[model samples]
Target: MDNSTLVKPFKSINRWHMLGWLLVAQVMVAFIGRSLAPLGVLIGQDLALTKAQIGMLPAALFLGQSIASIPAGFIVDRIGSKRLLLYLSFGLGGAFMLMAISSNYFFVLLMVAIGGVGYGTMHPTSNKGILHWFQQKRGTAMGIKQMGVTLGSALSALLLLPLAAAWGWRMALLAACALLMATGVLAYRFYRDPPSAEPHEPERKISWSYLKESIGAMFRHKPLVLLSIAAMGLSGSQLILNTYIVLFAYEQLGLSLLLAGMLLVISEVSGSFGRVAWGIISDTIFKGQRLIVLVYIAALSIGIALMVTQLPEGISFWAIASVVAVFGFCISGFNGIWMNAATELVPFKQAGIASGFTLMVGSWGVIIGPPLFGYIVDLSGDFNYGWFFLSFVLLFVIVLLLWAKRLANKETQHNKGV
Candidate 1:
């Protein structure tokens, strides 16, 4: 009856195979999660939705994730990643597939929110696996795994937009659903926990007090709180790009939908590399430090946000894609480091809870960011103002990171004194 008994035999799988399957799981979920972004224009036109409503599509998905994140973490810590992933994959894929039945805006919104529950499961699940399999190269490991998000997003743009252009958005959703379901089964079959020879411990019973203690400890650690909040800022900026860049390119820059989608693909590809590069930098250049890399990410993101505001109509497509590629590299790529820093603040056993808590907080950014950006664009009748808002948010993030670093230093000193 115990999960330990079931999972024991699977533990012999090489850790690299575990990592590979983890990446596959990541890519599948992300592919489904961001599927709506590239289709926003088509969905909007088909459904007769407003700009704000378009933003709400992705925002609604995030709302569901925020609602489910901590609970999913609890589940992961209890049942273990492989079993949980198998269940959530079905939930996520089925919910997204249901959207194909409705042309009604509210109905589609509801489905996206439901699918988001499944989408939220990946973070804590993958983080738990990484914490278990990787002892020394966590930053690098996390980075490699995190690439699934960007790679998946790029693939959605590369594959889904063209498919949608030819058949329809609903058809594209069906294709994504098939891939997700298959990936889930394959991952369950192949991905394994570290061998029981590696000092594996049984998971604790699901307990409210344990959850309460995790939240309490997270807040009490000021650096962790600040780090979590900074995640909110970065995540909001990332969502804005995911949700709006296609529309922005099509409407403002007068590019065709397919070309605008190409910009998104470029950004995502660059971000994929950035995830791995930032991880290696943290491990080698910063000597396993996280905050300093986060600081650089924040600063660079600010510069890129400012540049996006200045992008003019009639700019060369390659030129615009180049800027977007750089933006993606900074804004989209920083999460692996951010996640590594947040999880390290707590004990290893609590990695799932820590990941869930941080992502729960970050989900708020995803929930609010897109709609707010949409509202600003709707209000000012220009996408630039929306970007200006993100620049300010990132500025606030830099301040939060500095304060977090200072608190972390003080805590280190206090412990030394004790």
Candidate 2:
């Protein structure tokens, strides 16, 4: 219970080992959440869903996460991360099981939305775990953990889509359920709270008064607010790309379903590398100057968005894949950096709540961006317009990033003067 006892076990346990398990946990959660994406075309065709509805599926999933994220963050701090991760794994498995049995469009929506409840806990809990274990290399640790997300997403696109094509979407969901159940059991067996993490005190109940104070504190932090805004744009762009890219390739470019899925796999694989590379850059070259690195990455993302809009006819598969890889590298890479930056803006004790608030608020972009992109496609009969719209969103994000950088600079100066 004391600090010495807490520090003892952590000395014996390798931090990298903890990071690997956390990565696996993240992959399981991301796979369950993103499993619905590559099947969008098939599911849309089977259920007579419109473009707008396909977009709404991810929205529903993120909406559930948005609702639960803040509360989950608070809970992680109070109860510790290991048990929450176990519950999340089981919750994701149950949600996928529901998806496998779903009979209609609404049923699928309901189940996917419910799955977000587990997805909501992912960022705060995993980041808390990383922060607890690796203070000296927090950015690198976060990036490595976040790679699980892109890796899971890539694997789902590569493997599950083919499984769906060969078998059925239901079978794919069932297979995912089996994997998730196994992940949950593994987490329960091996996941442990870091020796440095705050022990859960049984006497203190989480109450409304505590919730209000914690939230209030987060809002009072200006850098967190600005960082959350930037996160909104980043997440929005990433979600729009992930949710629609396969369908766009299939419908607009006249690619086969398999080919389209391969394009997505390319993006996810590049994104996995991007997360680690960018994290190392932030940790070493920038020396934890996260926002500066974020701005550079965001600008690169905008360039890719413009390129996506300008693809010529008769492009080769590898050519298109190359473009998508750049898009993934720029847009999907900065999430861990964003999370690392947000946590640094507050005290260690407040890290979970700050992360929860940032994620909860930033998730609105995930909620709104995809549906809006889909709606634009429905209106214009062109996916180019959707890409353009995302470019515009990134432009606004650049402004916010600049503003955040200014604020960060002023804060440093003020502290030095004090």
User: What is each predicted model's overall lDDT from 0 to 1?
Assistant: 0.85, 0.85
> Model 2, residue 79: displacement in angstroms?
6.5
Best by TM-score: 1
User: Where does model 1 exceed 4 Å of error?
Assistant: 1-22, 73-86, 124-145, 182-207, 283-289, 344-354
* Each model's total of backbone clashes: 0, 0
RMSD of each: 3.8, 4.0
For every model shown, what is its TM-score relative to the native structure? 0.85, 0.83
lDDT of 2 by residue, 330-390 (tens): 8987887998889887889999788778987788889989889999999999999999899
Candidate 1 local lDDT, 212-231, one digit each (tens): 98778877877888988989
Evaluate model 1: give its lDDT. Answer: 0.85
Error of 2 at 60 (Å): 1.6
Off by over 4 Å in 2: 1-23, 73-86, 122-144, 186-214, 220-223, 283-288, 344-353, 414-418
Candidate 1 is scored at a TM of 0.85
